[model samples]
Target: MIAVVTVLLAFPLGYLLRSHLAANVAYAIAYLWAFTFQTLYLTLSMLGGDDSAFSKNEFPISYGLVAAGIFGIGFGLVALGHRVGSRRTTRQAVS
Candidate 1:
């Protein structure tokens, strides 16, 4: 169910932003990160750790960190892709 939604959302977004390699890479990274976090969250939640106070506090903090990391990775990928694409475009334009 979640996987279906993720794919549906990710594909067109990736395609529409494809013209800018940076945007494509950003979308991919963000989707991948979100997928990873969701998988981890579901797995942990299914294991039944929610009954504890420690679990409640830890989970939210962990989730926040995961989200931040995902955003950072996505931005990093976008920046790298943008640099590479710019170089390629410049080279082609020169030639």
Candidate 2:
């Protein structure tokens, strides 16, 4: 649910910012920003000792996998939006 919201938010921003930066750069920015936030939240949850969901998992590896998956899907959408925005601008220029 959270991932969906993040992607939804990123896509439009990426589309709107298409002219401001390269697609890859925007994707990298989005990826790093999201990954950092996730890492920080996990670290704080563990340090705060508030019964972290990450700690309760029998398979600790799942956390990394889930984060990767979320980033993969989320950032892919960012790139897709960038591409769409680029195409839209190109079409407008052509006409």
Candidate 3:
């Protein structure tokens, strides 16, 4: 799925971005951005006469929310990974 791939890709970038921002804030911002884009894209697709993605229904809205959540989780994983990585380095240096 595209959502999975996006998160997988974003995780590394999120880790790198942590150098500039705290991980929680960074992930929240990233999720909000991704959600905004997804909403816009879905709207445009509907306006362009694409009927496969939207309707007068709540399912699409929920799906979009889930997608954004997934991306946030992926971004958060980077922060988690950073913590694990730092611990390993310290242990290696000690032994």
lDDT of 3 by residue, 16-88 (tens): 5425256556556655676677678878988887877777444576676677578656666766656665666
Residue-level lDDT tens digits of model 1 in 21-88 = 64666576657666677767666875686544235434557655655575555555555555665676
By summed lDDT, which 10 consecutive residues of candidate 3 come out lowest? 12-21
Find the 10 residues in a row with the least total lDDT in model 2: 18-27
Residue range 1-95, candidate 2, lDDT tens digits: 34755565668766878553554466566667766776787778876875566664455687778867876676677777778888899999999
Each prediction's RMSD over C-alphas, in Å, is 7.0, 3.6, 3.7
Model 2 lDDT, residue 82, Cα: 76
Q: CA lDDT of 56 in candidate 2?
A: 49
Between prediction 1 and prediction 3, the one with superior lDDT is 3
Residue pairs in clash, model 2: none
Candidate 2 ranges beyond 4 A from true positions: 1-5, 17-21, 56-59
lDDT for position 44 in model 2? 89
